[model samples]
Target chain A: MKELSLNILDITENSVKAGAALTQILIDEDASTLLLTIADNGSGMTKEVLQGVTDPFYTTRTTRSVGMGLPLLKLAAEQTDGWMKVESIHISDDPENHGTKVEALFHKDHIDFTPLGDVVSTLLTLIQGHPDTDFLFRHSIRGGEKEVEVHMDTRELREALDDVPLNEYEVIKWIEEYLNEQYNGPEDAEE
Target chain B: MKSLAELQKIKANMKQRIVLREGSGDIRVVVGMATCGIAAGARPVLNELVKDVSEEGLSEKVTVSQTGCIGICQYEPVVEVFEAGKEKVTYVKMTAEKAKEIVEKHLKGGQVVEEYTIGAYQS
Candidate 1:
């Protein structure tokens, strides 16, 4: 994907297809590196599937032949002198044990790394598209010695709604504003 | 930032339409969103469908959704329309503009646009 947020959207779609009730996305950036992590409480992949996830030619979808989501992410990380990892375990009896976590680390200063696209829109799209699934997003950025973090939890928003549907137009607009306020605090407002 | 009261106002105004849309709809519009589809620019197509459907007040009759892939990488950015008691119509190499046209002719006018369909492209 041209933008990191698009890649996030693609991978989270995979989590939804896997029957995940909750997906957590985290983006942490510092002076030296940027880390992206997506974890899901879904039907975990088998050991074999996990091993081939980074291969561009291997895809679980029968539609078309190639799966570029993970492979492209891995390539992006590697191009920046970084790496990616995937961990999954299947234990039906234990909900915690049955899930997948994917983490990709990239050198922040590398020219090859793509910019994070409209992340606020990406989050809203996911929330509106899949109302039943809960999502948690955290963005933390550290420049020099100062660090700031912003977090959003859909479960909490759901509780505040008193059964109002999340996909309502007004709710979506509110979410956009909420993300903007949280992501761009007064101290580091984007111009 | 706007308060929840604003949302409540929208909710009250839209409650009836929302209920009808969610209760039943026979028409389904599905956009392919796999790796190939995304690379071929399916996001805009999907967004256009959702926006037009709601704006045109066709939400009560047509539902828009996304799918993984349609097994046609060559036809990336494909969209299929399914209506009750009618054959499914598949549109190939879709764009936001074409999606809008589809919403107008196929979904609203009840006449499929032959030029946009995959069958037309093949022939």
Candidate 2:
């Protein structure tokens, strides 16, 4: 992917395809490292699938002969002296307990690492696209002693909406503004 | 940040239209958004479809959605349109500009832009 947000978007789509009812994304950027974690309460992959997930040649979809999401992320991470891991636990009776987690770590200063582009747009797309699914996004940046964090929970937003859809144009515009203000600070708010 | 009061007004206006569009055999515009598609520049095409459809006030009659890979990696950035009681039309190697044309010629004008179709490219 050209941007880290695009990679996040692609991986989250995989979570949705895996039948996730709730997905949590955590991004932490420090002076030296950037970490991304995507966890989902979905149908966890089998050991066989998990083993071959990083192989671009392996895919579960009949419409496509290759799956590039995991592999591409792995390549991107590795290019920056980073690594990735995928863990899954399959549960037949309780889907809430069955899920998968994909995590990748990259060196923040690495030249090969792509920038996080328009993350607000990425999260909003996922939320609007899957209205029934709940999403929790946590982003944090740490430099020296200063740390800034932003958290967005769709479940809480839904309750506040009182039946109004999150994808409503007005609501989406609000969400975009909310994310920007939170991520970039109020001083840099977009007019 | 805008308040919930504004959203309430939008909900009141959109509820009926949204209900009518759901599960109905409306014109469905599906954009392929797999890794290959995105790498080949599908995001802009998808965004254009959403923007144009809404701008043309065809949101109630048309649904612009996304899908995973369609198995045609060579034909990246593929878009498929499915209308009620009609054959599916697949557009290949789509760009934002072509998406606008499709939105106008096919979606709004009710005539397929056959030149952009995969069949046209092949034959």
Candidate 3:
């Protein structure tokens, strides 16, 4: 339902929320399918955790955990005749070896994936575009294999890492709100 | 292909704005928008500047623009404010709420929020 960008942005926000150090987003736009993939280096959740994530009422955080991301992501992918799968390894060679990868698929002819603003807005969330974080985005469209790559670093937005101030938060939120306005195609776009 | 003259005409129209001028009576806020800025959440910050300025009726007094990159990607969502007769104030890690505060304090009151300014790090 709606454009796949909304799902893409939604899932990506989850990645940012998962305390990911680096998030990589890959979008494949073709005649057959408009595919979006988001990968992050956050703590890997177990099968039970993953299952719990899909349950709207279950939450991992004691604070606020509506557990809507994975479910919504699953729904969006299924609606587009695509599927979302999560693979996690608890026992890895590295301590920080946790990771999560979510993929959303879409039938190109049946859906409009040309509106890229949603994808942009999703990736520019509050936690995103931070100095400590780095993102690699690749978009392919037009079947010419025509493509574009956008690498956004947090440093470009701000430099003071010692302590985050109120002004900094305002500027970032303002930008987030701005992107939400520019990319209006998706209502459930983590707006 | 489009005609070169048409491009020239478009340029002429854009020139009416005179974006990069030596002396103008407008408050210019530049947000770095390279890959880093976007990752640093600069797009929303820039967008809010436009919305807030317009809503607050500061259209003629302030203008929001985007830059490719500011090199420093850490303090993203960065916003640099420049008035006609004042120093350049760089507000780092900006958000929608903070943008409003800046509008109220610095933009309106002619007072810079020193806490938000990247004082020693001015490059």
TM-score of chain A of each: 0.91, 0.93, 0.64
C-alpha TM-scores of all predictions: 0.86, 0.88, 0.48
TM-score of chain A of 2: 0.93
DockQ of each two-chain model:
0.30, 0.37, 0.04
lDDT (10s digit) by residue, model 1, range B1-123: 434555556666666666666767889999888777877878778777877887787877887877877887788789999999999999999999999999998899999999989998889
Top-down lDDT ranking: 2, 1, 3
Q: Give the residue spans of candidate 2 off by over 4 A.
A: A62-65, A93-96, A144-148, A185-191, B2-9, B16-25
Q: Model 1: how far is B6 from its true place, Å? A: 4.9
Q: What fraction of the native interface does candidate 3 get right in terms of contacts? A: 0.04
Candidate 1 per-residue lDDT, tens place, A3-106, comes to 78878888888888889989999999988898999999899888888888898889886745678888988888898999999988765546666888989999
lDDT of each: 0.82, 0.84, 0.59
User: Where does candidate 1 chain B have its weakest 10-residue lDDT segment?
Assistant: B1-10
Interface RMSD of the candidates, in order: 4.0, 3.0, 14.7
Candidate 3 wrongly placed segments (more than 4 Å): A1-6, A63-65, A91-96, A111-116, A126-129, A142-191, B1-123
- Candidate 2 chain A — worst ten consecutive residues by lDDT sum? A182-191
